[model samples]
Target: MSSTIDESAYVEASNGQACLAFKDEKQEARFELGVSMMVYKWDALSIAVENGWGGPESAEKRDWVTAVIVDLFKSEKIVDVTLIEETLLYAMADEFDTNVEDDSALPIAAGIVEIYKQCDAQDFSTVEKLYLEWTEKQKNKEGKRIVQVEEDPLNPDASESEEEEEDVEFEIEDSMAVDEMTENNTEPVVDEDGFELVQKKGRRRNN
Candidate 1:
C-alpha cells in the first residue's frame, strides 16, 4: 500500500507531525466508506455488537467506532497498523468493557491500509465489492448468526436443579432477599457461588 500523501499539505514541524490532507474530497469520502465496510467485517466487533456487549446501543457504538477510525485517518499524516490496532483495542475497552487480548485487529488494520491505497488510486472496485457483500449479508443475516449455548443433555435432573437455583436467585434479587431475611429473623444461608441458598422446590434435603 502506498503511504505517500499530498506533498503540498506535508509540512515539517518541531513536533515532527505532518498535516496530511486528501488529494480530493470525493476520494476521501470513498475511502471513509471503505473503512466503514471493513469495520463491519471485523469478527471481534461483530460478536460484541451482535451480543449487545456494548449495551442497548451496541449498533450505534459500532458506528461511532467506525467514525473514530475514519477521523483518525483524516487527521493524522501516517496511520499505521499499530496505531489502528491500538485505536480498536481502546474503543472496545471503553465502549463495551471488552478487552480484546487477541491480535485480531492487525488484519483489519492491514485491510484498511489496502483500502486506503486503492481509494487513493481512484479504484473503487474493492469498496464496491465490500458494499455489495455487506448489503447481501444484511439481507440474509448470514454471518451475524449467534449460536446459543445449551446445557448438557444427559443430565436432566442437573438441568432442573440449575433452573431452580436460577429462579431462586432471581426471586431473591427481585424481592430483596437480604431485607426479607432480616425481617423474618432467619439466618442468611449462602452457597459457594455467593448466592443465597434457597431450597429447591419438590426436592428434599438430607438432614
Candidate 2:
C-alpha cells in the first residue's frame, strides 16, 4: 500500500547493507545487525507469501514476520516484540473487531495491501503509532499492552477494505470433542485441506 513504510526518524540505509544506519558524522557506524536482519527477513518473507510459496494456513508466519521487521530494522531496539506485536495486532484487531485470542494471528497488512493500493490516513495513524511505540517498547521489553499498545479510540491506520474485515466474525465450533475423563487440551481435526475443525454436534456439511 502507499508505503505504510516510512523514512527512519534517526537512521538511514544505503545499498550493500540490507538495513538502516545510525546518524553519526564521525564513523557513522549503524545499528547494522538489527537493520540488516530485519530488512532481509521481512522482504524475503513478504515475497515468499506473495509468491504462494507456503500454505494458506502458513500465513501464520506473517506475524512472526512482522515481529522481526519492527524489532530489528524499524529504529527500534530488541526485546519489544510482544508490545510491538500487540500494537500491530490490536490495530488489526480493532479493524477485525475480534481480540487476538479469538482469531488467527496472521499478518493482515500483507493481505490488505494485496487488495488495496494504500492504507488511508486513519489507518496510517495506527501504523505510525506501531513504529513509534515499537521503538519505545524495545527500549523497555517488560512493559504492558494496555499502556503501550492501546491508543486513543479515534485514529487508526488501515485500508478501507481492511475496514470490512475488522469484525472477522466466525463460528469456529459447536461442540468440541472432550477428553473423556482427564483435564487436557485437544487439537482440532484437519481433513485434507488443513482447516482446523470438528463436526458440528448434529449437523452435516450439506444439510
Candidate 3:
C-alpha cells in the first residue's frame, strides 16, 4: 500500500485543528480541544514525518510514527482520559491511512513519544505563531456567520416561529398529562357472579 497519504483527506480549520477523513468518510482522529492542543498534535505529526516516518514496508518507521502520537497525548492534559487509547489508535490509523490493527499500533505509540521529546527540547515558536493566525481566521469566520444570520431576510419571523413552536409543545405536554390523569381515575366495570358487573353506558343504575 502507498504510504503517501492524500493531503485532501484532511480538512484544516481556522481553529488550528484538522479533521482527518479516509476516502471521504470522516475519521475519529479529529482533535476536539483548544488551539494549543491542535498545535501540539499537528506539530508532533509533522516532525515525525519530517524525520522519515510512515514509509512503505518499513516497520521501524511505522512504529516510530505511532510512538510520536502516543507520547503527544500523554504529555498533554487531555480533557478525557478514558479516550486516550481510542484517540491514539485512531490518530495512528488516520496518519498511516490504514486499519487500526493493535499489533501495528505499539511502535507508532513509541514514535509519538520520541516526537514529543524532540518538540519539548526544540523551540516551537513557529507553531505558536501559526496557532494565533488560525484562531484569528476562525473568529472572522464566526463573525461573518453571525452577521449573515442577522441579515437574513427570509428568517425575519424566525423568533416568532420559535415562540409559536414552544407554545404548541407546552400545550401538548399539558394535554398529555391531563389525559394520563383521567385514564388513571377512570372506573372499570366488573362482572358479578361473585364477580363484579359491567357498567353499560346510558343504562339506568337500578337496571
Candidate 4:
C-alpha cells in the first residue's frame, strides 16, 4: 500500500522548533503499531536477523531498532522520510555491520510515513493490509523452512571424517548459541503510550 502525507498535520512547533505529534492518543497508538509491522516486514532487516549478523541477539536488536523508530515519532516532531531512512540504514550498519547501499530503506520509510498519515486520518485500511500481508509471508516462510528441514536426510550410521565431525560440532555449537540467546526472549507488551514494555531477562543456563 502506498500513500502521501500532509506534513502540516503531523508537525507542530515545540519550543520554537517543529516536531512530529499524532493528532490524538488513538492515532499515536495506531501509528506506533504500524511502524513496528513495517520494521519487521523489511527484507534487509529480516535477512540480517535470520543470519545472526548482529550476533545471536539479532532478533532483539531488530526490536530495538523498531523501538528507536517509534521513539522518533514520540520524541521528535519533524521526522521525515529521509530521517527514517537514515535511522534504518544506521541501525543495520551499527548492529549488523551491513551496509545497505541499495536504498532498500527508502520504501520502508515511506511506508511508515504513510502509516502515520493514514492513522492520523483515522483510516486503518493500510495498516490492516500490511498486517495481513506480513502474516501471510510469515506462514509461507515457515512452510518453506519446514519443507527444507524435512527433505534433508539425517543418518546416524553415516561415517564421518574428523573435518566432518568438526563441521557438525560447529553447527551444534551455533544452534546452541542461538538457543541460549533466545531462551530468555520475552514478548514485548505495548502500552497505551505507544511504547513496548519488556520483561526482565531470565537467567542463562550453563551448558
Candidate 2 per-residue lDDT over residues 120-154, each given as its tens digit: 11223333334355456446644221212233256
TM-score of 3: 0.21
Worst 10 residues of 2 by lDDT: 172-181
Clashing pairs in 1: none
User: Against the hidden true structure, what lDDT does model 4 obtain?
Assistant: 0.65
Off by over 4 Å in 1: 1-18, 21-23, 142-207
On residues 49-157, what C-alpha lDDT tens digit does candidate 3 reach at each position?
3332344322233333333433444344421222333555564455444454434333323332222333444433433344466545545532211111133455555
Q: Pick the candidate with the highest TM-score.
A: 4
Give the winner by lDDT. 4
* lDDT tens digits by residue: candidate 4, 122-163: 897777676677656655543211111221245555456633
The true-structure Cα RMSD of candidate 3 reads: 27.8
Candidate ordering by TM-score (highest first): 4, 1, 3, 2
Q: TM-score for every candidate vs. truth?
A: 0.62, 0.19, 0.21, 0.65
The lDDT of each candidate is 0.63, 0.32, 0.33, 0.65
Candidate number with the higher TM-score (2 or 3) = 3
lDDT-better candidate, 1 vs 4: 4
As for TM-score, the candidate ahead, 1 or 4, is 4
Which run of 10 residues does model 4 get worst, by summed lDDT? Answer: 143-152
